[model samples]
Target: MRNRKLFILLCLLIAVLVIAGCSKTKQTVTQPAETPPAEQTTPPKTDTSTPGSGELKVHFIDVGQADCIFIQLPNAQNLLIDAGNNDDGQAVVDYLSQSGVSQIDYLVGTHPHEDHIGGMDTVFNTFNTGKVYLPKATNNTRTFEDVLKAIKARGLTVTPAKAGVQLVASEGLSAVMLAPNAASYEDLNNYSAVVKVSFGQVSFLFTGDAEEKSEMEMLAGSGAATLKADVLKVGHHGSHTSTSPAFLRAVSPQYAVISAGAGNDYGHPHREILQRLSGIKVYRTDLDGTVVFTTNGQAVNVETR
Candidate 1:
């Protein structure tokens, strides 16, 4: 009888323990999958301005007695406007090489003037030039012949630039021809290819050797009575016959550069033009060597070498 009672008690204890474990297991709950925090995800940023950022530079070289402006494109291409007088060949070439240029995309001779196109022969022979731009006219001279010979020898083609046509300087920069418009003239100065370069919000006016006639005509054609520019290359090296008061009021450039040789016979940067631009800051190659303007699309800062 004692053995039977002990066995029944042990069985009852085992059943109670099993029932308690099942009850606990049934009450226990599982957690659902967690959602990720919203802040962990972000969109990438895009730059909308200065498409040519970090890749383009424009330089207004100081070649004595003439002008040579170089535009370096982001694509590693080059565009040179004028090459100074014949004597500046070596200097111009050295400058281009120092600036890390090995080839030229375009060479623009505003007109057939010796001062504008003389050193181009050296450039064509030294580097690979894609094309050469000359006015749709010419004033045949030795200087012109030299330029022609260089182009021909290099097997390069000549393209005529006309008013209202646009040329690319860099990815976002554009150069628009503004003068030598349809009306032919006897004066070489009148045939100078005036160009306006626009990059971002700033603009620069490059009037090769345009005189009063070209300025007046350009102003009349705009129909706005005025042309606004952030910087201006003073026409004909700030000659009295160019940059007339009326034209000054029209363009109203904040900064002007005069590319004239020291003690040149022309007596450029005349007092009259200086007086007219008394309110604006002026830079002269005669005083400073090479003048450079750097733009971050919104503003332009100038530096001299």
Candidate 2:
């Protein structure tokens, strides 16, 4: 009887040990593994895949003694300022085509001068133009008439390019008119439209052919404080009649661009103007061919054709 009792106790102890082992194994198998944390990152401001998230390009086309600028905005929009002389129509069109431009969001004539608006009719006829901005000043020349006819054909109305008018006012970009502040002026050049474009920290001033009179008016008005720019399209193609010393002082541009033909008769880019642009870096279409400036809201890179 003692032997049998001892045998039963031994069996019970073994069974208890086996059951504990099985319970521990099941617990170990049911538990989950630990996971690691993910890494963090910051995205860049400029992303080409999204609209308004890219660099800005300003192309100063070589139009020979005339003005024709094409601006590729960060928002994938295009702006054309002047179109050179009438004979330069085809050249301007070809240049725009090669640049992959199908439409012009803004078209500015600046003034009624033949050299400024001469090829405007060609541009209006060729591309799908958005808003046409012209100063209130008008001329009786055939060039001006042709532009009007083209606008009528396209069923597009004119938006006065005058003081305080804002062409674009968006986050990171702004284009405001600062000149032609008055309704009438003695010289036709005073009627030229002056546009100031600000892209983040970089700014550009485009003065078509504004003379001293217009410059003075801008200085005397609310626009004076905003004249400073990184680049200045020298007024009147570097003529002595424009870009007055006071005006230059106010603008305080780091770079100046003069658009004139090589060996032109009018003696553009005059000595007086060169002397005034002493410290500032200068680029001329006659020498640089086509000058391009690309900016990413902070830094600027320049290229010449």
Candidate 3:
């Protein structure tokens, strides 16, 4: 009887040990594999080439012995100076349209010369205009009367573009009227609204047919110290009466631009004026077509088409 009980107990112990081993194998098979870590990466660097400066473009449109300048300000605003001859109205409008300009933030009629403001009426009719600037000078021609009618239609008032007037005064840009100093003058050209625009290190001087008299007055005025510029729009299409030696000395421009027609009757860009600009680089609408000057407050890049 004792041998039979011992045999039964040994058999039961062997069965229990086998079951425990099987349970351990099942747990090992069901376990998941461990995951690996992800790889690291570096980021790209930022561009800081032109710090705190924006692009500014000044377009000198070719109007054939007439004056028409379109400025694309650093603040994305547009400034239109003059509008060319009476026949150039549609061409001027088309050019502006192609350039993606729908509105003019500032409209300037310089003096009331026919070549300067002949198309002013058309411009007023076409674009949505902001501030209108004009010299106190007036003309009795039909061209000037048409411009007045257009102004009345638009309900826009004229702002006198005279000395001490500030057109733009921002952090990185400044445009101030430096001419039309005297209230009255013997010659109408003396009423030309001369403007000085400075952006960063680059500057431009726009003289609207201003003759020697106007230049002399500006030099004697408070704005004489600010006459220095990187680029100069030669006055009266580089006529001898304009761009006097003293005026050129005060400006000290590195580049000079002349707007005149090819083989025109006026004999524009006179020999004397060309001699005066011998040392400086010269660009002419008559030869170079439309010229464009782009700046970033530090450097200026020029493009001609």
Which sections of candidate 3 miss by over 4 Å?
Answer: 1-53
* Sort order, TM-score high to low: 2, 3, 1
Lowest summed lDDT across 10 adjacent residues in model 2 is found at 33-42
Task: Give the lDDT of residue 271 in candidate 1.
Answer: 89
| All candidates: TM-score | 0.79, 0.84, 0.83
Give the 10-residue window scoring lowest on summed lDDT in candidate 1: 29-38
Candidate with the greatest TM-score versus the true structure = 2
Please list the residue runs of candidate 1 whose C-alpha ends up more than 4 Å from where it truly belongs after superposition: 1-56, 74-76, 169-172, 223-226
What lDDT score belongs to each candidate, Candidate 1 first?
0.80, 0.91, 0.90
Q: List clashing residue pairs in candidate 3.
A: none
Per-residue CA lDDT of model 2 for 1-305, tens digit only, reads 99999999999999999999999887876663221222112233234346653788999999999999999999889989999999999899999999898999999999999999999998989999999999998898898999999999999999998989899899989988898999998788889989998999999999999999999889988455699899999999999999999999999999999999999998999999999999999999999999999999999999999
Question: What is candidate 3's lDDT per residue for 22-86, written digit by digit as tens?
Answer: 99887776653221222112222233343322678999999999999999888878889999999
For model 3 the TM-score comes to 0.83
